[model samples]
Target: MMTDLHVVPARRGRAVRLAKGQAIQIINTHGQQVVDTWCFNADDMSEFMSMEHLHATLQGIFPATGDGLTTNRRRPILILEEDTSPGRHDTVIAACDVHRYAALGCTQYHDNCTDNLRAALGHLDLRTADCPAPLNLWMNIPVSPDGKITWGEPLSKPGDHVTLRAALDCIVVMSTCPQDMIPINGAACTPTEVHYRLIA
Candidate 1:
């Protein structure tokens, strides 16, 4: 493993560049935590991982092991290599932003996934606008037949993890979601470990 970083509990995050053939693993050191993740083409920021593209390719609602994620243009981006969790991840939910907190009456500055992602990507010269919908690893959001979405705690257990291989050179940005107000992250936020290495 070339890099191993521990994200502090709630509202903390990190980002890194991975060459083609490299892989990364997001570990749920403690269960009930959701990893808000983003992937972007290293060569062109405009070409990023697209959830809509994945859904179409998979012909299913969620991604499975061995399924490949693609960019907006349908170019290959990442391949799901390993999944220790139930694979009940999410792609439809937008990262929490300032406006969301404001609506919750916390007008003051608060830690959020949207801002955390930007902070992690800051060194790369990327902005919040460059971020797209993330793959909410270990998150639990179920949609009913009536089209109502209900959020709940993660279905993952402690030590569960998911790994992804870079189909193309890209950057991985993520946040350890600090959303204590919702049950998307077990109603409490905690630290998680992100591990990466060149698979060769």
Candidate 2:
């Protein structure tokens, strides 16, 4: 069974519950918006997806279709079941926060992925003391041989999506990253909404 498409409003976040074996198809509705994604065990929030452990598990950074998304405990929580884009989802960048915006010269508070995750979880009456580094869906950060990283615009076209299948009962949280000072989302430096739906 497939549910109706849902929107993760621009510059905001959304969370969903996924039973074991269920999947979520997240759409890059406008083509270039980066969605910061996180997953936590429904039974134990502390056992959330860990990018560091994932790097060791996969022996690489970018997780493509068929790759197991591992948790802090080094077990599969979700698998990248499908990807319609160029398979450039980033795993190295930390979710943007007020400090990040401030470094970019923001004088006032700005919408951020860190806060977005917190608020999203709050709606579900859940909390996590740590904001684990997210799996940055569609974020294009090119790495050079010298280990330098250059923020590149997304290469995905409108409507491209990735299907992530859960291997454990968990909560999936997504945040349409609100970074506008740089062009990670797109060359336009504009953030936009993305869509998602649950699938059996």
| TM per prediction | 0.90, 0.99
lDDT measured at residue 169 in model 1 versus the true structure, 0 to 100: 90
Q: How close is candidate 1 to the true structure, as a TM-score?
A: 0.90
Q: Can you tell me which runs of candidate 2 are displaced by over 4 Å?
A: none
lDDT of 1 by residue, 10-127 (tens): 5687877889999887778777888888898888888888888877877766888998887899977989899999889997788888888888788688888888888888877866
TM-score, cand. 2: 0.99
- Highest lDDT: which candidate? 2
lDDT of 2 by residue, 1-200 (tens): 99999999999999999999999999999999999999999999999999999999989899978999999999999999999999999999999999999999999999999999999999999999989999999999999999999999999999999999999999999999999999998989999999999999
The regions of model 1 sitting more than 4 angstroms off are 1-9, 189-200
